[model samples]
Target: MPVSLTIIPELNLVHIIYSGQVTPKELFEETQACYQRPEYKPGMAEVSDFFQVTSFEIGYDEVHEFTSRSKSTHGGVDIGTDICLVGSTKVSEPAILMYEGMIAAKEIPIRLHVLPGYPEALAVLNLPEDSLKYFPEGCHTERHLL
Candidate 1:
């Protein structure tokens, strides 16, 4: 699979790693699958790492529609979620913008951040630096070590 999801119910966080080429359908389906998981809850935080994604074919409409339709079975429409996106590439900017625009329209508590990588994301999310261990090597900076 191009996208993998790891839900940490203890911290109310979700970790996502996406690689290879991803399609809009696949992305939506993967997210829906995660939302259906037992650990998913309202106001859960998410760190979506797209650092490994090589390429993708998506447009604003697709992203907007997908996000607008997100209503987790357990987490109702008003539920909030904090999202951090990891990646800094020319190709990633559009995705970030689309997400921001769509999410803003929802007026829910979903907050989004774009970080260079996992190290910065941890700080932004206020997670213990040691939590970086959950990610693979190179996901964190030496300063992220604690």
Candidate 2:
């Protein structure tokens, strides 16, 4: 299936939901399409809700292309990412390492909520706990519950 992308303004983040069936380039295009919308604004961070991601590949070239394109198109906005959840089961060490490396190399700070569900992700993201009144728990996923 084609990846789904959503931008949450309150959190200043972009959420990408994808199934491994799609290529990273396809997903990239979909995300770019969303940013092309006049209503879409450059977010400070990105969250890849791989909860449904079955399988995929993202090499250095793809990463560089995506970030460079985003920076140029989004008014020089930097990109940070949260990829704590993507598959149907537990996250793999290699995947985690890859994400960690990406975040480090890109120099973009990201938050990883190892809890089983989304609530924990929000907590790790440092969203105001008391401000839960202001932000709903929609973004919380099962991965955060771990």
Name model 2 segments beyond 4 Å from true: 10-12, 70-75, 78-96, 108-116, 126-146
Candidate 2 structure, TM-score to reference: 0.59
After best superposition, candidate 2 residue 103: deviation in angstroms?
4.0
lDDT of each: 0.74, 0.54
Task: Kindly list the per-residue Cα lDDT of model 2 for residues 51-127, writing each as its tens digit.
Answer: 55555566656666665554455434445334344333443334445545655565544444433445554566666
Which ten contiguous residues of candidate 2 have the minimum total lDDT?
Answer: 131-140
Instruction: Give the best candidate by TM-score.
Output: 1
Local error of candidate 2 at residue 26 (angstroms): 1.5
Candidate 2 clashes: the total is 16
Residue range 34-122, candidate 1, lDDT tens digits: 87787787567888888788876778888776777653332363656668998857766777787787777766457688887776778
TM values, all candidates? 0.84, 0.59
